[model samples]
Target: MSGPADDEGSPPPAGYVPAEGRGGFSTLNGPYFHRPGEGELAEQAFFARRRHANGLGLVHGGMLSAFMDGVLAGAVFRGTGKTGVTIHLSIDFLHMARVGEWVMGEARLTRATRDVAFAEGRAYVGGHDVVRCSGIFKLMSRER
Candidate 1:
C-alpha cells in the first residue's frame, strides 16, 4: 500500500503517525494516520495501483469500507482510551475515488458509554465526499 503522494512522491502528512501496530488488516490500507483535529481521526491512502482499484479504475468500495472501519475504531479508542470491537457499520458510498488520488478518512466519536461507542465518519478525495459512515462498537474493557 502507498500513501497519498505528491509530485516528489509519498510522504507522511504533518501531525500524522505511522499506524504501526494496528494489525495486518490495517496495514493494507494505511501508511499514515492523523488526528486532523481533536475528536477526529483520519487515515491517508493512495489508490496507487489497480490492486487498490475496481475494474472501472475507481477505488474499491470494500477498500473504502475497511478504511472507515479503521478510522472509526481509532476515534472510539481515542475517546474511551480502551479497545473496542466492531458491532456494526453502516456506510454510504457517495462518490467514486480514483486511482492516484488521495483518500482521507475522518471520523468522530459521537457518543461513548461505559461499554459502547457510536461514531460517524466520511472519506474524501480532493474535496469530494466519497463515503459517509456510522458505526457501533462494544468497548472491551474499562481499565485504563
Candidate 2:
C-alpha cells in the first residue's frame, strides 16, 4: 500500500477536493477526489499508485473499471438524487495509465425511468483516454 509520501510533489488537478463518505471496497481502493460540476455531478480523480498497478507496472484494468463504475454511479446520483446498484456495466480499455499519473474521470446520466438509470463515462490521463464505460443501475429508494 502507498502512504501520503507517495503523493509528494504530485497533486490532483485544480478545483478538486477529497471525496468523502466512501466506504467498503472504495475505502480500500482509494482516497478518491472530485470536482463539482454542473448540477449534482462531479469530475472524479485518483492518483495512480503502486497498489493500483499490474505486474507490468501499468495501472490495472480492474482498477480503471472500478473507477469508471463510480464515475457512472455518481452521475446517476447527481442527476436523479437516487442511489443505485449496478445491474450491468460495460468497459472498453483504451491506452495505458502508469503509476504516478493522475487519472481523471467524468460521467453523464444518459436516461432514467422509475426504477433504472443509464450512464456513460470515461477515464483519462492527461490528453489520453484510458477507459470508457457505460452502466445500467437499478435505482434504490432514499429510505434504503
Candidate 3:
C-alpha cells in the first residue's frame, strides 16, 4: 500500500483552509476539483434536478458519461500522486438509471506505466450496474 510520503516531491494543496470550508468555498479549493499537485479520487454528486428523461425520466447519456469521466480520472489521481489529463475515455451503457436514483462510480487500476495509467470503471445505481467505462490518463510527473 502507498503510505503518505513526507518527502513527497510537491507540497500539500495550500487551498484547503479548514475555516473557509465551513463558511463557504475555501481559499484552498475543494478536493473535488481538477487541481495539480493533489490527491486522486475526487467525487462530485448529481441530484435529481440534473436528470432528464425519455418522457419517462431517466438520466441522459451525456450526463452519465461525464460522471464516469470524473470517477475514473479520480482513480488515476489516487494511483499516481500527481495531476493527469484524460487522453481518452469509453463508456458502455448497460441499463437506464432512472431519475431520482443515484449512481456511484468507481475506477479500478488496470495497468500503469511511468507516464500513463489504464483504468476501468463502472457506475452503479444502488447494487446494479448502470454504466461501465475504461480509459487512459496521461500523468505528468515532475522529475526531481
Worst 10 residues of 1 by lDDT: 1-10
Better model by TM-score: candidate 1 vs candidate 2: 2
The C-alpha TM-scores of every prediction are 0.82, 0.91, 0.63
Model 3 agreement with the true structure over 6-93: per-residue lDDT tens digits: 1221232343211222113212122222223244443333332222334556777877776677667667767765555789999989
Ordering by lDDT: 2, 1, 3
What are the Cα lDDT values of the candidates? 0.74, 0.87, 0.58
Candidate 3 has an lDDT of: 0.58
- On lDDT, the candidate that comes out on top is 2
**Model 3 off-target regions past 4 Å?**
1-45, 50-55, 142-144
Off by over 4 Å in 1: 1-9, 36-48, 142-144
Each candidate's clash count: 0, 0, 3
lDDT of 1 by residue, 20-69 (tens): 68787767555545644554554544434456678787888888888888
Per-residue lDDT for 135 in model 3? 86
1-144 per-residue lDDT for model 2 (tens digits)? 566526642776899888888778997888789997667454899988888889887999999998889989999988888997899999999999998889999998999999999999899998999998899999999822
Pairs that collide in candidate 3 are 15-28, 40-77, 40-78
* Model 2 Cα shift for residue 67 (angstroms): 0.8
